[model samples]
Target: MSHDFDLNSPENIADPYPSYARLRTEAPIYHSADPDLWIISRYDDVRAVLRDPDRFSSDVGGLESDPFNPGLEMPRWLTGLLSRISAVRVLLTSDPPDHTILRRKVSRAFTPRRMAAWEPRIREVTTRLVDDMLAADHPADLVHDLAAPLPTTVIAELLGVPTERNDDFKRWSDNLINGLLTGGPRIPMVRSAIAISWFFLRTIRRRRRDPGEDLISLLITGEGDEALSQWELITFCILLLAAGLETTTNLIANAMLAIFDRPVLRQQLCANPELAAAVVAETLRFDNPAQGLMRVTRTEVTLSDITIPAGAYVIPLIGSANRDPDRWADPDEFLLHRPNLGEHLAFGSGIHYCIGNALARIEATAALEEIARRLPDMAPAGTPTRITSPVLRGLRSQPITFTRTKIPAR
Candidate 1:
């Protein structure tokens, strides 16, 4: 397959959805120019593959990636770390039995009842943040002031990390996530990972000595806590922090961007309180924060008339699938009244459906509601700066101007 698709190009990073759509329509499952993997787009194909762990694999080591191919010029330390840590992390990057086990352990901390318990706290924090933003100035960067902090705060509280430690968490997550790009001991990435890893190790040990109601503490004191080895605990905490912070942060930013981009839809959302869920669902479909996830085929299998060999890499384009024209009507248009919004693959589907979905939804919804209530006339002040990662889609900065300089405290 000789074609043009630049994964690292600045243009693609800024807006890959157009390319994803073209791929989905022309070749739903086709070999990439790199020839190392088979890229899968379209809603049915990606969702079906993600749903079946039997045919597809999520094992980090089993993944058919060559972040360190023979002549790639990749960083040595980064490759080494990738080869080592890939197999040790939590359920997100693992498969069946192990995935099930780790997910079960952490699942207790985020049950439906627990999510209900978190609602009040989420609202309180959101309101307080909005109050502070309003007090600061009218022309505020919503991405910095509202979108970023809300998720970070919620994730920190959930993990029992102190509010003061949020900067450390953000810094570490940014480095670690971006590190995956340069191939292993990417200095900043490794340093940040080591720092966070050490912090989690110390915190887990403290929890073991003096347990609390937080998720980390629960992981240390859960029913399977006795069976969990030390490495598992540390890896689990690291995975939690990575997903907990990054996913929700992007979700807020992406949702806000989608709403604000369409003035009519924004007006509808601001006017209709009951239709918030629909708006959120449409936002997820329109510009999903989690653009895609990589999977490996365990055996030679056929998907959508394309043959993928065993050990072949599979990139499921979530953002593309959410907008697949076959599955959605007027897929490109942002409609808050869209009926099939829940079917979107924003939180993913099947076993790997985000464990933090409820929390993310709560945090995102709170942000939108608060923004509508406090800064109804907030408008983008400049072109938003997008985060440069194919896997995670979001803005690095979004400057905005609100209607009033002084926001009321409700």
Candidate 2:
């Protein structure tokens, strides 16, 4: 198997499926010497790594290291500052015991009943955003106007943050995600993290004085000794904000792009609006928002006849695994009603599976349903711009045009 895979290459970034397919078939476990990382592309291999965390640990500090400064050769003061700001021990980066406890405490806030209750608000928000887009102009950038803001607003409401401050939240999330994705600069990323930390700290203090029916309050007042510390609470808040906003934003935008690419499918979805959920599922399988995640080998591990030394970085290619030929009949094609769509490793597997999976699905389903119902004839007005990052896969801007639907009297 050839080891020339370069994740940062322009060609690969633009369309990774081709490279992923070759890797899956030729080298399910390939090592790249340039970055000193192992790539796992097979569905079973990726699933196994995620499930057996005992062998493949999630405590890889590289997950949070600055992609720009991987060597940690910065000045002592700067390195210390980065460490302080970036040392977030959230569910995504913790192992069992700690992960189990954090997950249990956080699960209390995302009950099925609560998610069901959020559906109406999600629909209302979607309708309003689409209404604004319809009123303004044709060729509106849906990514910015709708797909992006909707999730930020939803997560803000869930976190009990003031809706009026949603723009601020969006800025913070964009800065953090862009920094992590492109390794643009260290200062802005550190500053954004610090600012978000201070905001959450203040919010936590306020919630202590005046408790509210929100996630912050739930984390603050846990059962027995399971409550989170101030730092943990702050880290958890930032984690929820970043994860909930970025993933769902990408899901909605990516689903829109995929559906619009196939006019027949788009029309079919519009005619039968209930199939919106199928669109979401198919999108997750075909073009997952999170392309892959990094996990380290806790001990020597053998995958696909390749022996990976202990303490080595392993990347599970979720996007590639979702489209593995062995896993699906027509792996690359977007079939809305694919029976195995739910089996994709999009939300990951095992205990580390996305806690906000339900929320993301609900939000995406609402967005798709509203778009199909209101803008049944929506069409792409220009080429969609894709976000270029090895880890995050999504559209940065999608210009779309549609006939304005009249809003009925209240």
TM-score of each: 0.89, 0.92
User: 362, model 1: CA deviation in Å?
Assistant: 0.5
Best by lDDT: 2
Count of clashes in candidate 2 = 0
Task: Report the alpha-carbon TM-score of model 1 versus the true structure.
Answer: 0.89
Regions of candidate 2 where Cα sits further than 4 Å from its true position: 62-88, 137-139, 405-410
Pairs clashing in candidate 2? none
Model 1 Cα shift for residue 310 (angstroms): 1.0
The segments of candidate 1 whose C-alpha lies over 4 angstroms from its true place after superposition are 62-89, 137-139, 181-185, 224-227
* lDDT (CA) per prediction: 0.75, 0.81
